[model samples]
Target chain A: MNQDSLAYLPASKLARLLASGELTSVELSRSVLERAEHLNAQVNAFLGWDGEDLMAQAEASDKRRKADKALGFFDGIPVALKNNIAVKGSLLTCGSRMLENFVSPYDATVVERMKAAGMLVWGRLNMDEFAMGSSTETSYFGSTANPWDLTRTPGGSSGGSAAALAAGMSPITLGSDTGGSIRQPAAFCGIYGLKPTYGRVSRYGLVAFASSLDQIGPFGHCVEDVARMMEVLCGVDPKDSSSYPAPVSPFHAELELALTGGRPMVLGLPVEYFKEDGLDPAVRRAMDEVVAYYKGIGWQIKDVSLPNSHLAVPTYYVIATAEASSNLARFDGIRYTHRSESASDAVDVYFKSRGEGFGEEVKRRIILGTFVLSSGYHDAYYLKAQLVRTLIRNDFSKAFGEVDLVLTPTTPSPAFVRGERITDPLQMYLNDIYTICPNLTGLPAISVPCGFASQNLPVGFQLIAPHFEEVRLLTAARAYEKGNDWHTRHPAL
Target chain B: MEHIDIGYTAKLARLELSKDEQELYSAQLGRILEYFHVLSSVDTSGVEPTAHANPLHNVLREDVAVPGFGAGPALANAPQQREDQVLVPRVIE
Candidate 1:
């Protein structure tokens, strides 16, 4: 196969090639690195990657295969990680100046699992500064442009992870989602990204954004590739008490079984989400087509109401910022983060260092968070938001009782122009309007390429399942993929 | 609610905002807070706050002595270090 075909093959296909001795891990890793290097200036997807380190890991996978002790079916595949997830000795900058030069001393639990599964850990993808913004524009390094349209953003704060997969720089990558960080970008970049149910994946060593809302998930070109990743990524982590104490599902096997079964799912369309006001016509059209497609395939479709989902954005901002203020307090210019040279006293260190280290969006959030959690406003804002959050969660629980899964447009629109919304924080926050509800409800949601909008920018539709029901979620997503060629279409690079 | 005091909020956050930032944040935050008033429309009477998505709380692990990251690695990323100690500006002065 030529470079484009080889580079863009799904991880499942690559695994087969490696297992059959038709390809070597070194060759695959080298070509991927070369493609990534060639495209980095245009897409700006990766922060940086060590080619030697990746090749060494790839070689080890090959050695294991040679000894008939290959780790698993996914051995020798390369997986990139968003900058926030740590890998020992690797730069762990969460696209922020605070950790611009900081390196991790230990691997995140997911990283340990990835190594054990023999997946080659590759590039450090870029993201929003402290995962605070919708567009990658807030990243301290630079913004990552959408591969489909260079002038537009790859939705973030996991923009780089989505763009890397779209540009064929990496076959599979991992991203953290707190309020649609993974799903929104995946929608923009036209790839499959799954935000596993909260607590389904461990957060140990993941730079905390909103501890309660954050989840680490996989992104890939196909549903099975993401399912393959889930096989090893799930399960309890001793270090992360929040991780669910559950057995790992045979995701790949489940994918095969799900693909062969008839579509017996009842998909719910949340009426509140389908409002005509803000949703772009193109996105609305794509979602309508997806609903029609499922209906024609003998699947049940019902209109459901999530009356309280409108409060998700406000509730999210309050709760996320409140948590961020507390979570980020550890960065006091004294520990493993940036310290201002102008500090003359101990207290001055915090003010000067944080001001210098954080970006505009990050500061805005920190201030907002602090204000909400501050004296006298706690019950009115932070606590009130949490109580409202319970209502939003109740909305989903009520909807799930009537439907097997919930389906909605992953975003309000396709990839937007890079600078179109950055100046307006509220406008940027709304980009995640459709995707954040699942995060609030702690439900598993997957974004798959539904169709293309105007200008050929890809749009995605999300399918959400009950908590810990990834098997059903991935199965349903794969059912959609099998009937469409959207996942196979690549951006003209 | 009235406009948030940018100076007070930034101070509480231990962040120093420039004059431009203060002005920008004051207007932006004012609009955002105004938007948040929509929450007051909901009847959250007697609703218990959901602090976490999962019900797991106070998860206790066996109190066993295990190896920890040695001081060398622990302080490896500290901005300023002396031997095994992290040096901060003297707080007692």
Candidate 2:
């Protein structure tokens, strides 16, 4: 296969090739790394790259294959991890100056699992500072540009992960989602992104953004690759208390069945998401096309109501910032890197270190979170937001009772220009308007590239399923993906 | 709606904001919090606050200790480290 095609082939196809001895893990790793090195100047997708370590892992996988002791399907697959997810002995900067020099001493649970599966993992992708922003402009490393249009953003928090996948830097990647970090970027970059049901994957190594809302999920170019990743990623870990103890479904097997099944699928279109005002014309057109396509394919499409949808952005900001304030308190200069040079006392050290270490968006969130959780404002803001969260969850539960899955636009619009929304925090927060509700309800949601807009930017169709129903979600997504070519399209660099 | 005192909140957050940052964040946060006022319209009077979406409770593990990263790795990322300990600014002098 040509180098360009080799770089962009799905992990499933790559795995098959590896098994048949058509390609070595070392060759695949080199192709991916070469592409990444060539594109790094313009894309800024990776924050750290360990070529030596990566080649060593690839050699080990090749050796395993030669010995007829291959670990798993992912034995030779190259995978990139969002920086927030720990990989031992690597710099785990969550795109912040606070932990800029910090090196992880232990592997995150997912990293351990991937290592066991024999995946070649080495790159640390850039993200918003502490995964706090929607546009990745907040990253201290620099904003990751959209691969499609170099001037536009790749969407964020998990922006670099999505960009890397879109640029074919890696066949599969892991990203943490809290308030749409994974899905939004996936939508923006026109790839498949899944935010698994909260607690479906262990968060032991994934840094906490919002304890209740955070989840680590996969980003890939196709639904089957994502499902294949789920087979390796899902399972209860004693390390993460919130991880569900339910037995993991055979996702890859279920996906194959879902693709070949003859049953007509029922999908709900929440009426609130399709409102004419403020919705982008191209996105509306894409949704219409997808709904029409599904209807033409003998799928049932019905209108459902998620009445509490409008409150998702506000409620997410309140709860996320509040949790961020508490979670980020561990970053005092004493424990981690990035201590201030001018500090006479402990209190002064904290004030100055945090002040200098965190960027503007991080500070803004810290203050907002602190304000909401402060004694007098807790009940009014924090508690009130939590109650609203229940109402939001109830909306999804009610809709799920009537429909097998709910469908919505992954983002309100296609990827915006680099500096378009960064200046306005409210505008940036609104970017997650359609994506955040899934996190709030802890539903399994996936964003699949459905079509393109006038500017040639990608538009994604989001499918949400009830908790732990990732199989059904991926199956449904695959049914759509098999009939469309959007996921296969790569940006011309 | 109550107006936020940026100075007071910054102090509470342990952030030392400069004059420009305080002004910028003060206006930005004011707009955001003011926007949050919309949540008050929803009647959550009797609703129990949900700390987590899933209902898994008491996820306990055995008391057996697993070997951990030794002190060398534990203190590896510290900005300032002494022998086997992180060195912070003097607490009492």
Candidate 3:
């Protein structure tokens, strides 16, 4: 197969080829790396990669297969990591100038798990600096362009992972979703992204953004690939205290069953999500089509109300930023790589280094976070937001009691122009309007490519399942994916 | 619900903002706080604060002194380091 065809083959197909000896992991890795190199200039999807290390891993995987000791089903597949995830001996920049040269001394648990599964973990994908912004533009490394339209953003902060998959640079990638980081970008790039229940996947190696909200997940060209990734990436990790102590599901097997004999499930459409004033007409039409398609497929569709839905954005910003202010306090220039040279005293060093090291958006968030968490203001802002958060979660809990899944538009619109909302942080924050509640409630949410909008950019149909129900979530997503070809569409790079 | 003192907040946060940033943030943060005023209308008088989404209690692990990254690896990324110690700007003297 030529480079494009080989690079764009779904993970399941590539796994079959590897198992059948029809293709070798080394060849696949080389083809993917070459494609990434060619497209990186235009798409800016990757920050750095070690081609030699990847080839070595690929060769080892091939040897293991030859010896009849293959690690698992994902053996030899080339997967990318978001910049924030720690991969031992690789640069863990988190797309910030603060630690641009920092190399991780130990692998994140997910990286260790992926390595043990024989997957050739290759490259650090770009993201918003410290995973702070909705657009990848906040990255000190630079913004990643949408593959569909270079002038537009590949929604972030996991823009690189989604853009890489959309550009066929890699078949699969992992990203962390605090608030729509994975799903929004996946929607923009027209791929499948899942933010598993908060503790479903280990956050041991993920740089903490909002500790309670952050969960690492996968981006794939298809639902089967995502499910296959979850099979490897999910489960309890002793290193993470918040990790769920539950058995990992046989997601691939479940997906197969879901593809064929799964019973139709009830889907809830929150009327509040559609009533937002700025929602694009094209997105509305695509959602309508998705509802119609599910109805035609014998699934029950019902109108559900997340009455407190309008409060999600405000509550998320308050809580996420408050946690961010606390979580980011470790970058005090005493331990990291971006200490200021002009400091005369310890206090001066702290202020100057943070001010210099952080980007504009990061600084803005730190200030906002600081304000909400400061004395006196804490009760009114932070405490109130937390109480409101419970209300939002309660809304989801009530809806799930009646419906098996909740559906909404992944983003209010398709990828906006790169510089469009950069100046208006509120407008940019609204990009996660429909997505943040799932994180707040700790539900498993997946974004699947539904159809194209008027501008021909991809639109996403989001499905949120109750916590730790990834099997049901992926199964439902698979059911939708099998009947549609939207996931098969790739951006013309 | 008045405008926040961005300078004081930045100081508390250990960040130094420029005049432009301070002025801009002062206005922007004022507007965002105004937006947050909507939360007051919700009757959360009896509601409990959710610190985390999942119900988590004290997660106890066996107290074992597992070997962690020693000083060598731990301080590898330090911007400034002396003999086996991170070199910070002198606060005394």
Candidate 4:
């Protein structure tokens, strides 16, 4: 096996090589580190990388294998994590200055699981400050550029994870999707990203964004790699009370079965989604190709109506910000966050520290949240948004009654240039128009690279399944991915 | 679009804002809230609110004392600490 290409190999193929003694964990770790060293200057995907720590974990994995006590198929693989997900002793920055110097004192539940399985915790990937932006540009550290096109954004707040995996810095990485964070970036970087059903994965140590909508999911070069990640990552955790009390789907097994031949599924196309004004011609073309492919494969495609789909963006922003205002109240200056040296009193610490710590977008959302949840406006904005949220969730439940899955374009368009939409917050928020409903409805959705658009940028189509139906979701994704070469095509970086 | 008092809202949220920030955010928030006005048109009469996404239950555990992270780890990231306590600006004048 050529060591130079080891970092880019699929996790499944890498596992087979490790089992066959064709590759050592140390060799693979070194290769990944070397690739990051070469590409990180351009991609800016990582917030922090510790070569010594990574090698230590890799050495342990190798020693375990040598002693015939290997943990499992993924024992030695390096999986990067979005910085918001805590790893003890690592900086849990969330790409914000508030926690820039704060080190996690304990592992997140997901990190604990990865360590238990002997998978090396690779490093912290960059993200929008506190997972609040559609593009990675909001990150305090710096924006992560698309490996596909250096001038454009790798979609965000999980842009770093997507970019890192797309650049072959890690075989796979995990990201939290509050709205379109994971899927949008995955779409932009031309990889696969899965936003698991809400509560399907624990969020114990994931720094809270919008608690109800935040879900940690995987990004990978192929559908199988993401399924492999789900196999290890999914499960109930007592630490995260919201984690579902459900059996972990044998994702890889189910995906393999689906690929060979799963029952034909009824895929729904939301008429509202297709009819939206901003639907890029290129994105629509990609979705058309996906619909045609699925139809060719004998799957049923039907036009469905999500009458309340137009309200998704408004409802999501209202609810997300209200929750964010409450959730972010924990970041007072006294604790493990940036304290304002200019403060003269306790109250000043709260106000000035936050003012200093948070970026423009975060502060904007916090104020928006505060306004909606304020005493007089609570019923008018916050409660009204929640009531509409029910309508949005009901839209999905109603549609699922007619179809096995819902398919749509993951993003409104291909990756926009770095500064294109940053100045216009509404335009940036609109980017999540198609992606937000799943977060609101608590459904599982995956973004699969459908084809490239103009400028050679990647376009992704999303497949959403009913709550906790990741098996069906991944199976459908595999069905589309089996003969498609989009996921295999890498950026020239 | 409803009028937003940026000064009052920021105070309620306990976030200090610069004069320039207040101006920029006010205009932006006005536009965003105007966009949010669309939700008002949806006649969601008598519809129940969906606060938690998934079906949730109160996770009850035996009322027993359990070992928690000690002061050392808890204070490890504190911006300022003294004798295992996080130090902050004086609360009482």
Model 1 chain A lowest lDDT segment of ten: A254-263
Model 2: CA > 4 A from native? none
| DockQ of candidate 2 compared with the true complex | 0.84
Off-target runs (Cα >4 Å) in candidate 4 are A1-3
Model 3 native-contact share: 0.85
TM-score of chain A of 4: 0.99
| Residue pair clashes in candidate 4 | none
| Predicted candidate 3 versus true structure: per-residue lDDT over A1-493, tens digit per residue | 6678887789988999999999999889989989988999999989999999999999999999999999999899999999999998999999999888889998999999999999999899999999988879999998999999999999999999999989999989999999999999999989999999988888998999999999999999888899889989988888998998877878879767765776789999998998889899999999999999989889999999999999999999999999999999998888866888898799999998898888888888889899899988899889999999999999998999999999999999999999899999888998899899989999999999999987679999899998888888888888888789998877777
How many residue pairs in model 1 have overlapping backbones?
0
Predicted complex 4: CAPRI docking category: high
Clashing pairs in 2: none
- Candidates 2 and 4: which is better by lDDT? 4
Stretches of candidate 1 off by over 4 Å are A259-263
lDDT by residue (A1-493, candidate 4, tens digit) is 4545776688888988888888899999988988899889999999878999999999999999999898988999999999999998888999899888999998999999988888999789999999999889999999999999999999999999999998889998999999989999999999999999999899999999999999999998888889989988899998888998888967899878876776899999999898878989999998888999999999999999999999999999999999999999988888889999999898899999999999999999999999999999999999999999999989999999999999999999999999999999988999999899999989999999999998899999999999888989888988888869998888887
Identify the superior model by lDDT, candidate 1 or candidate 3: 1
Worst 10 residues of 1 chain B by lDDT: B1-10
Chain A of candidate 2 scores what in TM-score? 0.99
| lDDT by candidate, in order shown | 0.91, 0.90, 0.91, 0.91
